[model samples]
Target chain A: MEKKFEIKDLITVGVFSALYSIVMFAVACLGFIPILMVFMPLLCPLVAAIPLMLYFSKIKHFGMITITGTLIGILMFIIGHPYPILIFCIGAGLLTEVVLKMGNYQSIKHCVAASAVFSLWFLGMVIAFFFSFRDAYFASILDGYGQEYVDAMKSYTPTWVFFAMIIMCLVGGTVGGLLGAKVLKKHFRKAGMA
Target chain B: MEIGVCSNKNGAFIKLDPRSKLLLLITISIIMIGARTVEVEGVLRLICAAIPLVLLLSIREYKASFIYLLLLGSALICEKHIAPYTHGICNIVLMMICGLITRFVAGYMMGWYTVKSTSVSEFITAMERMHCPSFISIPMSVMFRYFPTLSEEYKSINDAKRMRELGHPFSQPLTYIEYILVPLMMSTVRIADELSAASLSKGLSAGEKRTHICEVSIRPLDVFAITGTMVMFVLFLVY
Candidate 1:
């Protein structure tokens, strides 16, 4: 039988998108903490994996993950995030769907792997900061805030911080995926999503 | 249904088409993100600064608007001057705070305003007229409906957990997850199933053109809003 998403799958994706956006908004609010800001890229994917994986488990069809990711990207774009971020999110979602499909959407290992890949999409958040360290970026700031302020701001952000954020996202994704799998095994399975 | 944070209250914003509001949001975001010099940023800030004022004026929300304006004005001032004085960590922290205010807060506020003012039927009609594919329009329409229902569900779950004496989220992370996630997931599945059935029965998946009872036409306000924002955006880019 040809497998196309039914109306139910669409609704499921819609509901899941709203839930994901709300959770992400709460995470963004928490990121107001200066220290927590750096960790947010890491923590968001992990926290998000719970709902995400649950959604994934229930709908094991093709294109569902892509739909969710595209909706999220559009929502984020509508909320003023850069267009590039939307592209990045959709790409990550496509990869995640492929990974899950490869594992037949039934294997716990594949689910974890898919979750980890999906988490990497959060890397788009750091792109703005990363660009700010460049000479062109500095020139733009210099035009507005002058040399002294630009210098001060640049000095505050070390080059290593960018790399550190990337590393943290990977670590966070791995841990979050594992945690989501554990949750699925212990709780969601009993709840019938398994 | 309760409109949540985006309640309309018969504001002037509600008079404009949802498409116009969407266009305005896109223009402002592009300008804000692409802004390079302080002059451009300042102009963009000033433009965005008008949004809350308009919202407040339209809604007759004097107190809330006043507080919002006060906070916004102070943050702009701090971003321009106080940011230079603070050195090292303080400087970073202050800049982050200021950036948050200037860059994102406006966009979010505008988004909230649009959500509040535009009814779901109006939004769906606007999307359809824009030639959005059914795959997208169907899900987006459902997504809009999902938010209010989810809020209701969250409240009931909270009450149930409270009755069971489950610890608050702040007290026990693990137990909180166990209590909340399981029930939420289960209910979400059920809700999704029910919602799909209802929508399907309503001919949502018939692959036929759908019409709306919600009359959504571009008014003079929409034309002015879109044109005005576009002209301003072009002007900003020129200099």
Candidate 2:
């Protein structure tokens, strides 16, 4: 059987991509708060799950997540995010699509699991931070400020921060998926998104 | 909160073909990311960072350009004076803030410049000419159209919510979710349906060669920008 996507499917993906980018952008802005920076990655996927589930309920098609993810990645890349982050995002999207497909895109368990998988994309930001930004970031600071500053910075920033971020994102994704299911059942389903 | 979509601003960067602009975006991003702590490398990075500002100034976007310049300046100052004394967690937080500003801000500003300047028709035409597959191009074009429409809808929703005095976002979390997200989702679904129907009626998925009125040829400025970016990219690679 030859598979074809209708115009509606493409439009749905496009609209969802916009929604996803806007939400992510809003979350990114919230991350400017120094205190919130660590928590944002953890909380973002949960916040995003609501829309993702709603989008899935409407489409329930294979490859939709991949399409939406790729578009969001391109949008992020165009906006100034590093290329590795884009690659990670698309890879996570593909994984989420596969997870959802295995469950035939219907079960809530699969949806939540898929959201959890999707949230792993946040790891790319951390990876980018360490690989692309860390050394230069510290060096630029040391050069501009002094050695005392660099020493003080190194003492405060434990090496575990990145590992902790990954754990938090996974937890957030799980919680977000559950919340999205609850919302879908209580509101979106009644509102006709389902 | 105005969503910054492309405006019909006349600038040297805006005059270049979208494909060339894309190439510049890639090359500059690589150079910026690969930048080192060495004085010469840092200077090169600074010059690269100034490209967006110069382009914005050429378009007479004085206010926006100034704001961006201010951000860059502040990031430098903060790194010098404030970041060193902050303790463990505070130090990390401060470092991330500075990193966001210094490392990511230029690319972000460049992105804003690109998106705000290039019109949708021009983008679609360029993508088509580049022989990009329809799957990518169609969704991309639709996505471009979607942002402005979504922004418009958000404004209307915000006004309605304000009139009804829905609880503030921070104070009433569930209410905020229920009122704001639900309405937004419903409308989004409706809008998506309508847009798809409208586009289909116009033969968007006809799977035939399409004609566009937008002329998308590369100018000399594009050649110059692309050449400059390529040279810098090669330099970064060598050194």
Candidate 3:
């Protein structure tokens, strides 16, 4: 019989996705600090890698990762992120799925690679700054934050910084992936769960 | 009908259809986020904030509503009074915290209310009525039901850690985190396996559509709430 996403696989996806989002939310709380906000793209992926790698190791199905990504996007929206994030996340999920497929879903190396790729979705959280609504967004920021704070934010996040953040995300993702794999081996593998 | 009455027991004053709660959630979230980008009037913001607060109060979630009011009051006060005095980093931190609270509180409260008020079966049935695929609805329902369970599992793990006399997290961060996460993952995965087995035996994976004993209908109050929210949303856009 052809393989399909049984209830078992879907439930597993839901559970792990919840775990990933909780970890992501914990890291996201750091964004309240303006300086830390700049590094969120890196920090989120680094912190979230353990859960993502563990989730990847358990799943042999094709669309499960994509579903997890979409679900996270929806959760982000629920928590007040822009709708454009959904597009970015879905794209990242698809890319991660493709990367995992290259290794036939079993290789530890591909799992690490996929983890790095999956972390790219953090880009969605900041893409709003590059949108045409920048002026309106900044205006809102001005109203909320003082003029000095807005100026500081503008200086902190120039156009190049967006690309720099992307690079940071990839690097952080790779490092996090390696760390996550080690953690998985030391713990889950020993338990025979992964 | 039995399940409907049972679920409505919590919110006896106003029984919103699950669809209305969903609509209320979307409206509140959009207004909250868009209010920052666009020049939404203060009156509209107040109304948006009030919608959830009033609903929460009506539902008898006194503690949550009280907390929401307290946070909103403090955020507004900090923005108006306290944030002006601070300089440099202090000013930035205070303003950012206030901005986040003011920006997100309404939407967050609305989401909390929706999730708290609606049961899993009702949510799935509502999605089914809206023609969402089972793939989306099933996992969403499971995710919603699992959050509290996750927190409960974490507490138990923490209790175990304390009993084991694990080193303080600050002293040995890696070991502490590993101890917490490894057991949490193991327990969560084990729970998922058991949940799946239980659900499968309950016919959750049955190819046919499932029926709910809970009644979900768009009553007059639902119409009132939906139209009220839509009007405010349109006003926020136009003005």
Enumerate the candidates' DockQ scores in order. Answer: 0.53, 0.44, 0.60
| lDDT (Cα, tens digit) per residue for candidate 1, span A1-194 | 13976788888888888877776776677786667876887878767777777777876688888887888888878766666678878998899899989998787778888878887677665565566435655665554454555676567456787777777766777777788777788876775666
Q: Which consecutive 10 residues in model 2 chain B have the weakest lDDT in total?
A: B1-10
lDDT tens digits by residue: candidate 1, B6-114: 3344545346787988888777666554565356556665776686468656756577667667777787788788887877667766776776676666676676566
Q: Is the docking of candidate 1 incorrect, acceptable, medium or high quality?
A: medium
lDDT score at residue B115, model 3, on the 0-100 scale: 76
Give the range of the ten consecutive residues with the poorest summed lDDT in model 3 chain A. A128-137
True contacts kept of 1: 0.57
TM-score of each: 0.86, 0.85, 0.94
Number of clashing residue pairs in every model? Answer: 1, 2, 0
Sort by TM-score, best first.
3, 1, 2
The fnat scores of all predictions, in order, read 0.57, 0.48, 0.49
- Give the residue spans of candidate 3 off by over 4 A: B1-6, B36-40
Q: Where in model 2 is the C-alpha error above 4 Å?
A: A79-82, A129-166, B1-14, B81-95
Question: Candidate 3 chain B: worst 10 consecutive residues by lDDT?
Answer: B1-10
Score candidate 2 by TM-score against the native.
0.85
The model with the greatest lDDT is 3
Which docking category, incorrect, acceptable, medium or high, applies to candidate 3? medium
On lDDT, the stronger of 1 and 2 is: 2
